[model samples]
Target: MVALRIRPAIVLFGDSITEQAFGVEGKVGWASLLASDYARRADVLNRGFSGYNTQMALPLLPKVFPPSKDNQEGSGILFCTVFFGANDACLPGERQHVPIEEYAKNLETIIGTIRACFNIFSSAATKDDDKFPIILMTPPPFDPAAWRKCRDLEEDGRANNVAKSYGEKVLELGKSLGCSVLNVWNLLEGATSPEVYGRYLSDGLHLNEEGNRKVHEGLMELIGKDHPSLAPLEAGATGEGLAVEEKLWRELC
Candidate 1:
């Protein structure tokens, strides 16, 4: 359970990208790095499930982000990033494929649910009162060359172009839903070299350090512009608005 002190949470919800955010083997994932950036300001919750598609991800939202009390005010969800599709775009017969059409619908449903959960504070406010926002991230591009060497190409899975299609659809969904987005697929593609694109993917699937850095940069850009409220508090201030314990340890010692 989250401590009452950390009422607001910056939730990083997605598949393996999230799961590996705070890496176990010493290297930190982008989410963990971002969490450090916002340390003391808010709690960053990681909700990544490896190999999960949208169909598998939808059911888990309510359990993690239940509705707040009707009158509760403030940043309950600081923000959430609904990232999926890496697995959903797997080619037919792969363990993770989901039809592209259904993928769009699933995203809509998830965003709607998120709004409802956060809307518990007011049923009468105009659109202006809605300050919170969710971000949607397109999955990173896949590398066929890496896949060919690491796994059987005949087994079925996505290629970089196929990933681009899914990524574009995600951008469209974000626009129609009025949500922000981080198009990592294109960001990576735009910056990577044709000769070294494989370096970005540790296994033609999971991200490597360079890929994670790209995600971190993309996310920081979005949050800095759209949701500055979620940024780390000034030096010593906590999310609540003041720094009650800034000097506590020194005083106690």
Candidate 2:
């Protein structure tokens, strides 16, 4: 009897940024790029929820990544990206607003859960699965003017200053927790005026085509540099190419 060999999952867990990662209207999203890059090698699962904050994500963790011993569905998580805080950075009275301190704590809790689950699942499979890489992404730059115009509101629900605070916290956590960080905030806003940075966003809050490309490029760069073994296979690839489940048709022929 043959045993089941499941493809390892690259989980993109977060808020609207992740949820919309596959994209719409003929636009390709960062997650979609990953899916293509890892085609036939790994499953890239999008677990993004629009309007969700860290506080809301906490309760969903268990259900999303259950224990492997109980359910093999959670057994082969290659890695996951945590991208939240956009909605959480909303104004004080907003429904999605979570205090900065609480948001930090919530992120810690979420990471802890993933580590625990990954350890259990991988340890059962093999000792070589000792490390589970996690990438924490900071919220992209928020353009209050764009958001106000997009939403047609007197005042935007989020502010750049408030969002920046959240991104900083994510950076701190990445260092302390030894997780790779995709600093979207810096990637989009680095020393640029709002006029320039604002172009990356669609509704001043979400990513546009160029913005998605930036994120996809950043992710590919990180995986190639930091986790080269997991990078997709290509011509003349050395350490960058990960082995696929089966040989290519050309190889078989």
lDDT of 1 by residue, 51-148 (tens): 89999988997786666563245445667888898998888787788888899999888888878877665332223437347889998877776777
Candidate 2 ranges with C-alpha deviation above 4 Å:
1-5, 73-75, 123-129, 235-240
Residue pair clashes in candidate 1: none
CA lDDT, every model vs. true structure: 0.75, 0.84
TM-score of every candidate: 0.83, 0.91
lDDT (Cα, tens digit) per residue for candidate 2, span 17-79: 999999968899999989988887788989999999999999998888775556655437777
Q: Which 10-residue span in candidate 1 carries the lowest summed lDDT?
A: 122-131
Question: Cα lDDT for residue 77, model 1?
Answer: 62
- Each model's total of backbone clashes: 0, 0
Residue 182 error for model 1, in Å? 0.3
